[model samples]
Target: MKEILPRQIESLMNILGTIPGIGAKTAERISFHIITSKDNMVQKLIDVLYDIKENIKICSECGMISDTDPCHICLSPERNREILCVVEKPTDVITIEKTGEYNGLYHVLWGVISPLEGIGPSDINISKLIERIRNLGIKEVFFALDPDSEGETTMAFIASKLRDIEGLNITTIARGIPLGGNIEYSDMYTLSRAIRFRTRLNDNL
Candidate 1:
C-alpha cells in the first residue's frame, strides 16, 4: 500500500474521531482500511449512509426510528393496545421486543432524568407520553427503565404524575441480582425482575 500523506490521514482521523468511543488511533485505523478497501464496498457504504439520512424518521407515537411516521409496530394490529410499555430509548424497545414475552404498545422516553447533567423531564418526550395516556385510554403502563439511579428517579417522577389518573395500573419490571451468578455483573433483566417482585416500598416494622 502506498504511504498515506499526513494531512489527508489527519483530516480523515478528525472526522471519525468525532464519533463516540472512537479515538484518534482507532479512527486512523478505520480510515486506512476504508481508503485501501475495494471501491464497490466503499460506495455501498456511502449509499447506505445517504439512504438512512434521507429516509429514516422517528415514529410519531413511540419515538422509535423508522422510515414511516407510525412505524410497523405501532400500525400492527397484533399488538395489545391496552398495555403500554415505557422504555428509556428506542433501542431498549427493540431489545424488549426480542424477548417476545410482551405484546403491547410502547412509549420511548428518549432519555432519563439526570439533574446532574441538566437533563430534566422536559428534555424528553414526557408531555407526549402524558397525552398518549389520556387520549388512548391505555389500561396499564409497564415501566421498563434501566436498573440505575437515573432510571429509578425517572420512574418515581412518572409514577407520581400518573397517580391521579383513574383506572391505570402502573408496574415496573421485576428485579434480581442477575443470571451470571456473581453479584457484581448482573444484567438489566435480572435487576428489573428483582424490582418487579419487590415487596411494598413502604415496609414499616
Candidate 2:
C-alpha cells in the first residue's frame, strides 16, 4: 500500500503501538485522535508527563512510587504495622488496597526473581524487605505475588529467608487466584478471598 499517513503521524503510531496491548490499528486511531483534537489535549498530556517525571518519588521504605519518601501507607498509623504484604510492584499494592481486604503495610519488590531473565534476589528489593520485616518487628508476612512460576519462586525464596525469624508467620495468598493469573488483574472478590484464606507457607514448604 502507498504511504498514506504523514511521516510524523506514522512515527507516533509506531511509538504508541509499542505500549502493551495496543495494536497497530489502535495506535493509529489514538494518534489521529491526538492530532485532531482541538482541546489542546496533547499539550495537557505533555505537561502531565513532565510533571510526573519531575515530581514522582519512590517510597524509601516500601519502594512504592509516590510523592513522598515513605508513601502514605507507610506513614498511616491506621494500617497494621505488624503484618506486611509483599507484592511485585507498586501497582499490585494499589490492586490489593482496592479490595479493602488487607490493611497491613506493604513492601513492593518492584519485580520478581526470574533466573531465566537474569533477575536474582539482589536485583529487586528483597534485602530491604528482610531488613524491614526485622526492624519493624512484623509478626506475619503474606506474599501477594502472581501465580506464575517466577512469582512462586520469589515467594518460596523469601519464605525460606524468613524461616529463621522467631515467631514470624509466613504465608501465601490462597489458590483463589488462578494458577497463572496476575494479582493486579484479579477481581476484587477473588483477591479478597485469596487474602482472607491465605495459608501458611510452612505447611506447604
Which has the greatest lDDT?
A: 2
TM-score for candidate 1, residues paired by index:
0.81
lDDT of 2 by residue, 55-75 (tens): 899999999999887899999
Instruction: Provide the lDDT at 161 for model 1.
Output: 77
Q: Please report, in order, the local distance difference test score of every candidate based on alpha carbons.
A: 0.76, 0.91
C-alpha TM-score for every candidate: 0.81, 0.93
Candidate 1 residue-wise lDDT, 42-158, digit = tens: 788789999999999999998889999999988999999988888888777766665556788999998989999999999998988988987888888877776677877888888
- Candidate 2 lDDT for residue 99: 91
Off by over 4 Å in 2: 1-7
User: Which predicted model would earn the best TM-score?
Assistant: 2
